[model samples]
Target: MRSLAFTAMLLAAPTAAQTAPEAQRPIAASKIVLVGDSTTAVIGGWGPSFCAYHVTSFAACVNLARGGRSSGSYRAEGSWDLALAEMRTPGYKNVWVLIQFGHNDQPGKPGRSTDLATEFPANMARYVDEVRAAGAKPVLLTPLTRRMFKDGKLQNDLEPWAAAIRKVAVEKKVPLLDLNVESSAAVQAMGEAAADRFAQLPPGSAPIGPTATTEIEVRPMAQPKLSFDRTHLGIEGANYFAAMVTRELAAAVPEMRPLLVR
Candidate 1:
C-alpha cells in the first residue's frame, strides 16, 4: 500500500504560463480565494498549479487550505477565519472563493468528518453564505476523485460529498465545479498502465528512471501512473487536475473567462 506524503512547503512564486489562450481582454487584479483541505490546498494540492500556472495574469490567488482537515475541522482549526479575513480585505470586491473538501470529511476520522445529516451540507452552506456576506462570490467544487482502480476500473469515493456539494451549490445558486466527475473521467481515459506515472515510486526509485526490466524505457509523454493513495497529487498530477479546473471555471463563470486561457 502506498501512503501519500504531505510534507511540502508552500511555493508562493508563480510559474511561467503554459498554453494560454491566443488573446484575452485584460482583467483587473482580483482575489480568487480557495478554502479547502490538503487536496485543494496550495502546498500539496492543485491550488498552486491553478493559481500559478493555469490562470492568466489577471487574477491573484489566496489559497487558505490545510492537510488532514474536513469542512467541520477546517473551520474549527481556524482556517475558515483566515479565509473570512481575506474576504474582508480591500481590493477583493470581485473576489471568488472556491471551496473543496470531503476526503477528510468521511466518517472514520474524528473531528474531521462531519455528520452528514446536520453538519456536512450545513457546513458548506454556511461557507456559501459567509462568502456572499463578505461581498465575494462563492463557488463550491466537488471533491476531486481519488483515482483508485478496482477490478480494472477507476473508482471514486467522493460520491456522497460530491452530491452534497451539488445540492448546496443549487440551493445557494452559486457556481459549481464538478471536479470529481471531470477528474475521474480524465484519469480513466489515461488507462491503468499509463496512469501509474502519477503514482509515487518506491524509495530509491526514480520517477522517470529506467523500468525494472531492460526492455522497457520510460517515456516522457506516457501518462505518469498515480499510486493507490487516495489523497494528494504529485506535481504532474496536480497540474493536470488544475487544468481541468481552470478550463471549467473559465467556461462556467463568464466573468472569470478573461482571467483564464482556453
Candidate 2:
C-alpha cells in the first residue's frame, strides 16, 4: 500500500550514485533466477524460503533479487547485468528467470517510480528479450499484494501495475504468475487483523514473516517492544507465499514443475 507517511519519508532527494555491485562470486548454475525488489529479495521477501523449500535437489533456485530497486534502477545499478552473468554460467542446461516488481514503481516512491502505462511494460518487455538472448526462459510475476484494507475490503491500487505486467506477459508470450491476485485473495480470506500476522513485526510480537528470527535480533532500545515492519516477511510468510508460487508454477509452468519440490 502506498501511504502518505511512507511517501513523505522518502521525499529526501536520493544521494550520490550507488557504487557498482561487488565482484561476482561464481556459484553453481541454478535452474531459476528471481529478479525483483525488496518484496522478492532474500532476508526481506519470499526468495529465501522460495529457494530453500520449493526447489528440488535435482535443480537449484538462485534468487538474485535485491531490495529498494525498480525495473529501471536495477538495470542502472548494474544488478541486472550481474543477474544476466549468472544466467550465462555454464553447467546448467536450462534456466528460468522470474521477474516481479511494481511496489516501488507505484505513485510515490521517489527513486524507484515508473509510469504505470508505458515505462513499466516496456521495461518488462526488455527484460524478457534480454533473458531470451541469454538462453533462459523468462517468467513475469505480477507484483505481490500489500495487505492494506479499508471498510472490510482490500485496496487494489496496485491493480493497474498488475495489469501492466499481465499485458506484457501476454504480448510477449511469457509465463505469468499473478502473485498480486493470489495474495490479495489469501488476505481477504484471512481478514485484516489476521492478515497482519504476515508482516514483519517487533521482536517477541506474534505474526507472519520471520518473527522467530526478526524478534530475536538485538536492537539497541531502552525497551524492546517498539519495533515493527509491515512491508516485509519472515520464514513463515515466505513459506506460505512461496507455496502459492510453487502451486501456480506447477500448473502454469508445467515444464518447470518437474524441477520443483513436490
Candidate 3:
C-alpha cells in the first residue's frame, strides 16, 4: 500500500521543465505600425530592416507604407482605413503608429501633391487625431531627405515639408522623429559620391539635374521593377537608416526602448 501511494504522489507532481514555458511567455505583446511613402515601404525603404532587425519577438512591426503615397492620397485610397483597423485590433498592450510622408507630397506629382502651407499640416494633424481616436499612440517623422547634392553640398529641397511636419507635431503635442535633419546631416557628411552607394542600383549615366529632386514614381504591380535612384534605398542604406530610426525612435518613445534592438 505504501509503495502504491508513493507512485501516485510522484505522478501528480510537475517537473521544473513543465513550468518553464509559462514563465517564458511574453509579458505584454506590443505592435508598431509604420505609415508613409516608398521611403518607408518594404522593397526600397528602411521600414523593412527596422521591422525585421530592430524589433523583438514581443512586438509586431507592420509596415503599411506604399510607394507614391502622399498624406492626402494615403487616406483617399483606403490605406488609412486598414491602418485604423490595425490600431483598433485588441490584445496589444500598446500600439504605436509612425507616420512619415512628404516625398510624394512635393509639387509636380499628380494626384499626390498637397499644398505645403495648408493641406499638408491639416492632413498630418488629422492623422494624429485619428490615431488617438483609434486607441494608439502616433509618432510623427519628418520626411527622409533626398540625396541630391550640388557644388559638393547636399540639397535639402524637402526642408519646407519637414518644417510643415514639425509644426503639426508641435501643435498636436506628439512625439517627433526628425529624420530629415538627421539623414541630411549624415548624407552631407558622406558627400554626393559616397551617398550613391545607398541607392537601390548604381547611378545612371545621366547627370544629376535640378529636376532630380523627386523620385521616379513606382506603382504597385505584379512584378515591381526597381531601379537606382537618389531616393529609394538599397540593403546597405536600409540598414544604415533603419539603425538611425531605431535609435531616435527609442528616444522619442522611451516605453519602446526595451522592445527595440537599439
Candidate 4:
C-alpha cells in the first residue's frame, strides 16, 4: 500500500508541474524568429526593437536576419541554414518565422537579386514550406519600402516585388504584412527631409564610425551604422517599423497575437 501511494504522488508531481502558470512553465509558450535581409537585420532593420519591446515573456524572440541577403543569397550563403537550425530547437510551445525580402531582390544589387516574376516568389514559397516542414509557422512580409521621394510623391520601386510576395502568400495561405505599402505611406507623411530620421544615419548625427548588422545590436552598443548603408535604419526607424510589424502580426497571425505585449 505504501508503494502504490508513493507512485501516485510521483505521477501527480509531473501533472502539477504541467499545469503551472505560464511564467512558471518549464517550456515557454512560443519563440519568434526573424528572417530576412538588411531591412529585417538588426543594425539596419526592425529585428532588434521587435525582439526587445514587442514580445511577451511567454515568447522568446530570436533575430537571425542578416544584411545584404536576398531570398536567393540567404540560402546560398548558408545563413538560412543557421536560421532553419534555430527553428528546429526543442521545447518551445510554438515557433514562428517572420520573413521580409525585396529591397535586395530588386535591380542594381547583383548577387542578391532574383528574377522578380519567377525566382522571387518561388523562393518565398519554398521558405514557407520548409518552415512548416521544420514544425514552425511562417509569416511573410512584403519588402519594406525604401524611404525615397521624387517631386511630390514617395517613389515605390518595390511594388513589383511586394506584389510577388503577396501572390505567394495568398497561394500558400501564409500570413502577409504589407510593410512596403505601410512604410512608404509613413515615410511620405514625414516628407523627404524628415523621412531621413528613419535611416541608419538619420540626418544630423555625426558618423559613429562604421558598423555591421551582426555586431553592435548583440554586443555592446556602437555608434549607429549599417556599414555601407544610410538607407537602412536608425533607432527611431527600427521602433517605428517594429511597431508596424507587431500591429500587422496581431491582425494577420492569430497565434502570435496573444503573445505580443504592448
Q: For residue 227, what is the lDDT in candidate 1?
A: 37
Best by TM-score: 3
Whole-model lDDT, model 2: 0.82
Higher-ranked by lDDT: 3 or 4: 3
Q: Pick the winner on TM-score between candidates 2 and 4.
A: 4
Top candidate when judged by lDDT against the true structure: 3
Using Cα atoms with residue i matched to residue i, what is each candidate's TM-score against the true structure?
0.77, 0.79, 0.86, 0.82
Model 3 misses residue 156 by how many Å?
0.6
By TM-score rank, best first, the candidates go: 3, 4, 2, 1
Clashing pairs in 2: 197-208, 203-215, 209-234, 210-234
**Residue-pair clashes per candidate, as listed?**
11, 4, 0, 1
What C-alpha lDDT do the candidate models reach, one value each?
A: 0.79, 0.82, 0.93, 0.85
lDDT per residue (tens digit) for residues 42-73 in model 2: 76688888888889876777888988889988
Q: Which digits, one per residue and each the tens of the lDDT, describe model 1 over residues 1-262? A: 1232322322433444543556775545788898888788754578878888867666778878887899999898788988998888885438899999888988899768788767899999999999989898999999988767887788787888899899999999999999988888887888756555554453245345323545457544434333345456667767888888998898778899877755
Residue 156 in candidate 2, Cα distance off native in Å: 2.3
Q: lDDT tens string, model 4, 1-262? A: 9999999998777676687876853555688999998888878888899999999888989998888889999999998899899999998889999998887887788787899889998999999999999999999999888877789688888889999999999999988999888988888888987877777764565666645576655765556444323368878888988998899889988777889965
How much is the lDDT of residue 10 in candidate 1? 22
True-vs-predicted CA distance for residue 104, candidate 3, Å: 0.7
In model 4, pairs of residues that clash are 200-233
- TM-score of candidate 3 to 2 decimals: 0.86
